[model samples]
Target: MSELPAGLVEFLESAGWGGAAIDPIPGDASFRRYFRVRHGARQAMLMHAPPPHEDPAPFLLVAQWLTNNGMRAPEIYAQNPREGWVLTEDFGNDRMRDWLDDNPDAEVSAYAGAIDALVALHRLDPGPFSPYDLAAYQREAALLTEWYCPAVGLSVDEEGYRAAWDEVLSPMLARQQPGVTVLRDYHAENIMLLGDPREGAPQGLIDFQDALVGHAAYDLVSLLQDARRDVAPELERAMLDRYIAACAPGPEFEADYARLGAQRNAKIVGIFTRLYKRDGKPRYLELIPRVWALMERDLAHPALAPVARWFDANIPDELRASGGGTIA
Candidate 1:
């Protein structure tokens, strides 16, 4: 662990949370770190974010937004912006993944609530919000070539890849949909199931610091085509249908969903490749085949036929074969 920031201990003491046993919590891809500070029967989460690589403003803003909108994000109890330490409400360890692992029946039912939450977000008119524009999308999509090519020590046909990407995204962008307050990573691992299995509301949502004004389908795809946990096909179909029904009645929903799924799967392939090569996190590699399979399936839909053809024509045989034998 790095040096404890100045005034953190003093601040905790001032807040009456001092002398609490602090244990570091594991972090995901972000630069921010967390520690669980236990104080008798109560507990609080202590966030440690070092300079430059971490920023708390977005987290604070989004928390305020979600809370005001009736979602159950952790409330900020104490904060020191200079030291980048924040003491927040502890939502506990009952993550959706853990709960579903313990009680399989809860998996399908619990997702209904999450899907409802997403519908609420998508329905909101995103006035004055920043868009997750083309530049950001392209930068994220480039990660596959950036990391995987270098890691494998194979030179990528840059022009060919770019052409393929443009070929797919161009038409899709032509029919670009409206924006919403996209949670960006609304998957099982980031959600917590609060209270008892038989009763109580699900109360925790974390790792939403990267929220953006993006397509409604982005979060839906993140939830259904999860990279961390496997949501069954029957459940995924049901959830997708549930979301479509919740949206304003429209003829374009199915077509948009297919296009978004292909686009999202493309982005994930790039992201997972980047994680493996740049971050040395090889666990994501295991999910690539599954994601690719989904992408292929989505592409087969008439809406994404161009993308399917581009992939078949451009992506090298070696790269396709690297999909761990799970790509059918």
Candidate 2:
């Protein structure tokens, strides 16, 4: 029998879900928990984001902001920010990722549909969030050296790492403000394949509490260059073209896409290594090779020249090729 959290029963009663049955659901890469709540014929997903680590307030606010603006963010039925909990509408089991697995032939169309959601999302005036600024980018990019380097027992040039990111990212400093609500984890796994494709918001977006007013290219990179899955190169290009046709964010889209892709990949590598070495989760280590592949591809872009040079000098090809394989 799964034990309910303290006050959860009362909380459910107060939220009109009194005596609801709660079943645990697997959480994501964060300090949060989830449960499926059932009351009669109704089912809703409970987001248990305990504070001092995870905050449900931002998730609630951002979710409503999205729904109010005609997006398909989950509907929050009730919340206790103090407990970092919220009962939200269940989006069902069809993640765009699993949907793709069953419908391999539908990959292109599924991605195209996902891109449509992105297009619709970016068109909206962004909600309140901190800027994904130069300092933030530099801080994140340095994580590669901060965690991954030490994990692999290689002492890298941390200063060069920051310098490279600075050079590549500094040019776009003016492109900072008025960015769209970047669903920071806007990948297939986080997207729910809701009903009819022709209906209102065919996609149900989730895991967006970390959203920020950042480069429009950021989420596009996230979707195309996924860390958890492989997106074909040709399809990646096609989707880029499709998004360009729809939103036309700017002429600098391609460069920014590559630049941010590299930066985000670096962050993921560090975080994954940290998950293993510091948090005792080794499964994430397996994803590092794929992330490195994507990072290298992004680094090939002209806009990533400075960072590329740094990687060339500091990180040996054999080390990256090992894919954290040698790391304990």
Candidate 3:
């Protein structure tokens, strides 16, 4: 078991919730760590984000944004900004992936709710209340290069990658789909199954510290072109259609979707590579082929042919091959 940081026990006690049994939760790629504490009938989750590497402000801000917008994210019970620790309502471990594994038919319905949540976020007025802005979008997109490229022992052709990114993004940005408070990681794993029968509102949402202001299609690609799970083609198409119809993106919808999918998948390929080589998480490697397949399909679209040709000529076969197996 990972060691709990010193003073965590004391911190919990000071929060007025003593006598609670604490269990360490697994760590993710970020500097943040999670813990579960049980105190009689009441339970809460504790987040330990060490200084410099992690900050609790974005989580707090976005949690407020999502909750205010009618989503069922964790409610912050108590917090200590000095230590970067937060106590929040427990959302449970039954994520949407596990729930769908048992009841396959519920996949469409559950995912529909997720898409609905996305639509709600998109439709909400971004007045003084919304915190999303342009800088955050660029930062999140840059992570694809920062985290993923070096892990494969491959350097991105900086000039080529930028040119390709611009070629694909320019037109979509021109039409500028109005920005929203995008929950950058709106995939199945982040969503939770709430009640025992598991048929009501979703209970949890995690890994949202990187929220951004960007295109409507960005989060959709993150959901449909998932690295951790295989979203069915029919379901993916249905969700795409649902978003298009719900948002009424015009003639450029298909083109924007195709272009954004390629951009997002390329970033993901780099990310998955980094996860295996740098982060010591080889399990993500298995998802590379699926991500590549998404890229291939997106590239096949007439709108993205130029970017497709560039990838085929520039990205080495050996590097792509390495994505399927252990990084070495």
Per-residue lDDT over 128-167 for candidate 1, one digit per residue giving the tens place of the 0 to 100 score = 3567776666666666566655554656566666665566
Residues 48-100 of candidate 2 have per-residue lDDT tens digits of 78878888888888998999999998988999999877999999988988877
TM-score of each: 0.87, 0.96, 0.88
lDDT of 3 by residue, 43-65 (tens): 99999987787888888888887
How much does candidate 1 score in TM-score?
0.87
Candidate order by decreasing TM-score: 2, 3, 1
As for model 2, its CA RMSD to the true structure in angstroms is 1.6
Highest-scoring model, TM-score: 2
At residue 64, give the lDDT of candidate 3.
84
How many pairs of residues collide in each model?
0, 0, 1
Of the two candidates 1 and 2, the one with more favorable lDDT, higher being better, is: 2
* TM-score for candidate 2: 0.96
In model 1, state the lDDT of residue 242: 91
Highest lDDT among the candidates is held by which one?
2
- Ranking of candidates on lDDT, top first: 2, 3, 1
Can you list the residue pairs that collide in candidate 3? Answer: 148-270
